[model samples]
Target: MSSSAFRTVPASADVVIVGGGVMGVSTAFHLAEAGVRNIVVVERGELGCGSSGKPIGGVRAQFSDPLNIELGNRSLRAYRDFPHRPGADIRLDTVGYLFLLDSDRQVSDFAAGVELQNGLGVPSRVISPDEAGRLCPYVSTDGLVAAVYSPADGHARPGLVVQGYARAAAHAGVTIATHTAVCGIDTAGDRITGVHTDQGRIACSTVICAAGAWSARIGDMVGVDLPVRPVRRQLAFTAPLTPPAPRIPFTIDFSSTAYFHNSDDGLLFGLADPDQEEGFDTTWTPHWLELFRTAARHRAPALADMRTVGGWAGLYEVTPDHNALIGRSAELPGFLYATGFSGHGFLQAPAVGEVMRDLYLEREPFTDISPLGADRFRHGAEIRPEAHVV
Candidate 1:
């Protein structure tokens, strides 16, 4: 749909969502499934126009944090069976996820992580460098002492998943207004009154902040300081190889935080910039390519010969603890949060949708998300950080 159709916002809605990415649409779908259909999803631009569409689509359960592992497990199941549940084929391929370790210290940390992941039924195990090479034949495993491989972890088409949720939500009578920018969140004495969009005002008592990188801005409107900051992450892809490489698992060099995976007979790779400044800046830089080239050559020497085809930049809604902030806000009663997943939001959207829906309906959530609440930061509680976040 074009922006022209969104010239006028509805007078009111039972619930007003601030973003139309995968998280918002999935939340709407789950809410509709739970018999709440009077929902409005307002997107500033097209659905999945943000980080949701730009992720390399890696999904895994090999996490150190217990809650993160649980979220990943549930999301993995949903991705495996999403075609029936959400009625869309996301092209989920469980080739696997392999993390290469360059030192014994990393191996030791990963071993502990594997123990916890296996305890939670993740089936992650440590392997020798030779074994890792066998898993990914092209990767040069030099200077690598160990590796962690989880066969259940994989990648999927992120855009398709978002579209699937949007379709399901629309079918369930959830109104999605694209190109509608939210100007302000109206409140009256600590209670949400409505949302003022660029088009018009929407009289909604409940407002959900699923605005991805812009979540903190939305929080500011309601007098709440959501500790979510936008950080730029860049990815580059190579043209199709001459001899099509074998299906490669999502491989990460844990030391440098550089990773790559198979995509369209080519390779999709990226690196986390250590000097990247916080804020919304999506410019693709040559310095990033240089950093990635060095990392890739050290991990997979063969990749040095492949010419760069194209790439994109996206935002990571990084929190202080590199986790998510979910649940209702104490400052404002009806204001809820479903953002700040760092870079793991796309993979965990399915399970988060269900959890948020349950919380909104005053039912017991499938998993205990108390640790991920905003109050954790305020109360000075110890944050259980996820170790493997590439």
Candidate 2:
């Protein structure tokens, strides 16, 4: 589809998806492929301007939870063939993911995680500290008891992935309305009848909440209190060195919650601060610069001399269990959730799109996603949070 294809929004659509991030666009793409072409995606900003734009694009099936592993595996398959399927090059370099462990407990825990992953058809393994060093030589191995390595886990270009989905969705007859804010969900009784947006009311029965950090507010428009909060995360890009950093897998120092990897021009790194407050705040904290430096020096001392060229802060749509809440909302009929992916939404977008498509069409999903339902929390079901989140 050409750029002029999105000149206007239709008065009615078969499906009205709120949010134009990767999740929303992916949902539209899969739905269109399912023969549900009368789909309209509404985004308050440009496509992928939300958390999807700032993602590090880590794709992996090394999760401890079975549902996460399944989602990752399905997404990994899609991403592997994305260049052909979506016709957009995401620069998917499968350099692998290396998680450095510094304690015996972590080693034992990850060993079990690897076993579980392997059982689920993921070839993740726990490796020795020496092997970890061999895999990512620049990262410090001091005090490291062991490591978990997933050769199939890797990174991709986030912007390209989002664009790929958006373009494919548009080509498949999905209408995308940018700068369109959904002010409210027009519902009759317990069923969604349409969505009232800044532009106008779009009459549609099915409403998908894929608004990332702003998902809770979207749910509120439908009288549903979604248990999703946004937390600020900062990532920095270093100046391109003469030889650049050695091409290494996305490596994480587990104990310190620090991670770094080689990009096309330089090194990209981030650290999780325990002091981070929950909200929609994306302001960069001055004190975090020192923390990041300390983490880099401790984990990858080779990055010590590299000057930070640029950095940006983004939001993580966090849930109580640090996992995503997918599936239909019981209270609000015809309302579906494709939000609260914590920090793993980019990698899990493909699988989520397929699953949401199946559910919206009232067909049995390819994989059972009942475990990711919001009802789990409502019914006091124990939420099994994914252990592998960076």
Candidate 3:
């Protein structure tokens, strides 16, 4: 659809989904496909202008937790079938994901994780350093003790995924209101009545918050706690190589949180800065590239000094436990949310969309997502941190 068509916001909708990123669009598509009507997705900027606008997104089911694994695995299947279903290529490259380990403890932990993933049909396994080197020739394998490999796990273009879902949703009668900033939420005796946007007020009985990094503000508007904070994550792309980059797995140095994979004729490098402050700032700083360089000097020496043409910076909507918050509001039944995905939102969008659709329909989802409710933090529940984060 053209930008002109998305400018007008409807006065009323059966469901108002805040944020037009992958999660929002996916939810819109699923709900529309499920026979729900008069759905409107409100976005402050263009669709996928938020975190979902990233260039390449990794899709994997190699998680230490079963819930996360199921979410990833199920979404991977949807992404594989995206071209036929929602109908878009999305550029999914199943080059697989490789996690390089340096310590015996790391190997032991990954072994347990591999066992769990395999039992859940992830096809992930622990391989020796030699096998890891064969999969990704760029790796030095100097300090690498072992590595976890999942051939089905890889990366896809997030922007394309967003467009695919948005197009599908729009074609299904979903009104996608771009450049429509949600200003306030109307409530009455614990029930959400409408959503006030910069364009206009939309009277909606149900509100789904897939607002990504800005979700906490939306939650506050409705007196619901989302506990999501935006943290900046940056990555750089290498200049076109003299000899085109080799086909390699999406490789990661687990200890340093450094990762790299083939992109175009070069490679893309990224690392999580341990000292990064929590905020919504997405300015792509060259300083963080040094962190990736430092790790590469030890893990993959060739990438330590590779030239970078440019890069992209985006936000990771993080929760205290680093797990997603997916549930309906206990106080306000009309409000529902699926955010705080940390860095896994794009990979898990499809499955979470289905969960949100089922939740809105008052039907049990294929997998029990009750444990991921916001109430867990309110009750001080001890949640395990996902170990396979990169």
- Which candidate's TM-score is highest? 3
- RMSD (CA, Å), each prediction: 1.5, 1.6, 1.1
Residues 261-344 of candidate 3: C-alpha lDDT, one tens digit per residue:
989899999998989999988998999998889989999999999999899999999998899999999999999999999999
Report backbone clashes per prediction: 0, 0, 0
Q: Write the per-residue lDDT of candidate 1 for residues 1-390, one digit (tens) a residue.
A: 212347798899999988988899889989988899679999998998987977458888888878989999999999998999979999898999999998888899889999999999998999999999999986787788999999999999888998899988888888889989999988989889989999899998899889999999999998887899999989888888878878988988898888888888788878898889997878887568888788878888887667887798889898888899988988787999999898999889999999989888988899999888877888898476665255
- Could you tell me the lDDT of residue 337 within candidate 2? 86
How far out, in Å, is residue 137 in model 2? 1.4
> Which residue ranges in model 2 land beyond 4 Å of their true spot?
1-8
* Local accuracy of candidate 2 as per-residue lDDT tens digits, 100-153: 998889888888888889998888888888999889988788788889999998
